[model samples]
Target: MSPLNALNWRYAVKQFANTTLHPQQLEPLLEAIRLSPGAFGLQPYRLLLISNPELRSNLLLHSMGQNKVTKASHLLVFAAVQQIDEAFVADHIECMTQQRGGTAEEYQGLEAHLNGYFRNMSDQEKVRWADQQVFLALGNCLTSAALLGIDSCPMTGFNPEGYDQVLGLAEQGLRSVATCALGERHAEDAAADLPKVRLPAQVLTRVLV
Candidate 1:
């Protein structure tokens, strides 16, 4: 099916069936998110794939009473890196050097640029910036799931601090920003039959030219 068709066929699944997505079905969606773009290519976030029933049960408590948190086959938490500093920028540059067959020193200019950019932002602004990167990954996950004939529900109606504690994110220098629940929609989900509500193209966007 075309991308447009896949998107039209997908929705924010409200009820998930008692079905687990096979590894084959789950990996590609993960790859799509792995390839998601981010500001400065820093990709200042981590994807937490949670499948442990016990952990999911713990997370459900922080999920605003959303059973989908536990019912979905897998829970993907997008966590922003709490630090986007010189050390982080240097690491990314070194990675680029290794991947592209160059010396880390050769990428010093690029590394300096990224470090300077982050240095100007206040701590709170840096946090917000990293959180924004997580959303880009979330969008990629949603689209990839739809294209792969999987159901997904992106959610933010949860407690972040609670998640950080339950997931031990703070010590890892990460903070939860958003989550996506992946699985098969329940057969009796009324939401599956509801029409999508969206604004017309003219209202939603405009041509600059």
Candidate 2:
């Protein structure tokens, strides 16, 4: 299907069928997330793909028993770094060096700039900034999933604290910011048949002259 049509057809699937996505169908969704853009290219988040049934059941408790939490074939948790420091900057710089075949010396300017900017911010500020970036990645993931004909539901109703402990995120200095449950939609899902409601484009958008 065309991207526009695919988007129009997509919705937050409330009822998932008992089906697992093929690897071919799953690969693009993962790639879209891996390639998601972040502020300053820092990518200050980690994408945790959870397929373990036992873990999903536990997560459902933290998610207020949202059916999709356990019914969906795959769960994608977007985790933001709790803090940004020189160490974080250095890691990205090193990865860039290997990916682009440049010396670490070539990235010193960028590294210094990022390190200084992050260091000046308080922990609260860093977390807020990282959280914002995670949402951007969430948007990308949702749109890409739609284009791939996958059923997805974006969720932020869960308890991050519960998730961190259950998923053992504190050790990694990551915190869950959002989640996306993906699978095939149930045939009886009435939500899938409802017309999407949105304000008309003219009323919802404005172009400054």
Please provide, for model 1 over 1-209, each residue's C-alpha lDDT reduced to its tens digit, 9 standing for 90 to 100. Answer: 57999999999999999999999999898998899998877789888999999999999999999999999999999998887788898889888988898898788888888888888999999988888888888988888899999999999999999999999999999989999999999999999989999999999999898
lDDT of 2 at 74: 93
* Whole-structure CA lDDT of model 2: 0.91
lDDT of each: 0.92, 0.91
Candidate 1 backbone clash number: 0
Q: After best superposition, candidate 2 residue 29: deviation in angstroms?
A: 0.9
lDDT of 2 at 163: 95
Error of 2 at 176 (Å): 0.8
**TM-score for each prediction?**
0.98, 0.96
